[model samples]
Target: MSDQEASQTSGVIKKFLYVNRRAPHGSNYAQEGLEVALIGAAFEQDVAMAYIDDGVFQLKTDQDTSEIGTKNFSPTYRALGDYDVKKIYVERESLEKRGLTQDDLMPLVYEDEDDDWEEKPMINLVTAAELQDIIEQSDVVLNF
Candidate 1:
């Protein structure tokens, strides 16, 4: 078996790249998606969560989750650091037209500010080329 396959079976480390592409609380799946990410982290797997396209909504600032009366698990995202799985990245263009600046998302994530703003979520954004590299590097990928 390949090292990655062997590792996965041996329970050594399974590197997963989680692709989140929905708004938080917009649907029940988004919340459940976060749960899966955390569960993977707890298993001591190397997990990285990526917010692409509309998935950026999952990391919006000042998310007043009380109306839902559901636990705001967004805060728990920070706790992923404790699991040593803290590579959270949001798409640059995704942050722009949403009227969200980098600092606007600080508490939620460490996003980069030096990029295009006031653009469509898909315009002038990181090319799929970049994402391909990330996908190739990960042992497995889960989409939400």
Candidate 2:
């Protein structure tokens, strides 16, 4: 095989969407969702995460899980970049209904190697309609 042919190949790349509608720390859903997302990224699939309802709290800054005797894993979302899972869609209405703005959330960013390590925001504040479209376009939709 030619060197170029050896370097280039195509495989089944599935689009995975993880829908998080539950509050973090209330149950294992958010944490487990993140775990699944990381696993999907490790498989080199196209993965996107959607935070709706109370799930928006998952990405909120200043979470004090210590009060409840559980370790806060909010920081793990930031590491999604290392795994190439960049798309994190936060439902705008969910945030507003919860009295949260984009500034209330953690700034999740990833270094784009192709862009000379330029930092890019991973959290996408999307509308309900937009989020619906995202879900419709995904090949595999996993709701938690």
Candidate 3:
């Protein structure tokens, strides 16, 4: 069904939070979580994603998986905005512990349809405390 049709049949719009705590490679948790988040967004749900622990590595730029024989799915993250999946949260402590900064991540942005199609960022670098509040506010939390 289309997003509008799904929304109409679902009644209440739920806030879905997909939490990622795994690295981008090695396993499928990160990729599977991303697919689920996009699916939720396609259903017209309020979907957001949080990256903690090694999950922060999923967004880090300049990733090369050639040696591992794994496809680099990092570029797919850039399409989250197209699915209307904004509100991506990255834990501050995770970045610090990894010695990485926002500059090391891909620049993900979305066009605000209600604001004359103005482009805006989707990534929100938040602290552990703020992330906790976000988790509490979510109606559904899926971890990977």
Candidate 4:
């Protein structure tokens, strides 16, 4: 293999997990984090995103970006699929606290549930245990 092939190989990770624990549009943290996820996805990285606590706010409905005086990047969440990085998972308890159900979330908020709605329900929430599994399955982890 050439040096270029070796460099590309070195950049790949088995899995890359990012834990987003902040609200969208509060600062640039959430925005930058999502950028990282998208970049990883574009690079063909096995990227996964987890919403913990306030991170659920990122999936909130009908954002008022005009008042915030910034471009609304909220809709970009749905575009992750274009980059093949839609392995989105949320915490069950966080949903309950936010009074939000999977159905309540917007179209962008993707939960990795089976497509067969009849054969399997579409709740893609993971308990704290499963969150641990997410971490364990990841070869590289980022906390944002």
Q: Residue by residue across 1-144, what tens digits does model 1's lDDT show?
A: 245654565657767988888887767777888878766654667788777777877766677888878767777665555545557767776777577765666353232234432211211234356666777899989889
Tens-digit per-residue lDDT, 99-141, candidate 3: 9999998999999999998989989999999999999999999
lDDT of 2 by residue, 32-94 (tens): 888988766646678888999999999989888877998799889889888898889999999
Q: Which consecutive 10 residues in model 3 have the weakest lDDT in total?
A: 1-10
C-alpha RMSD of each candidate structure in angstroms: 8.5, 4.8, 1.7, 4.8
CA error at residue 99 for candidate 4, angstroms: 1.5
Candidate lDDT (C-alpha), each: 0.66, 0.88, 0.91, 0.76
Best by TM-score: 3
Clash pairs detected, candidate 2: none
How well does candidate 2 match the true structure in TM-score terms? 0.90
Model 3 residue runs over 4 Å out of place are 1-8
Off by over 4 Å in 1: 1-11, 108-128
Candidate 2 lDDT = 0.88
Clashes of 4: 0
Is candidate 1 or 2 superior in lDDT? 2
Model with the higher TM-score, candidate 1 or 3: 3
> Which regions of candidate 4 are displaced past 4 Å?
1-7, 10-13, 109-123
Each prediction's TM-score against the native?
A: 0.71, 0.90, 0.93, 0.80
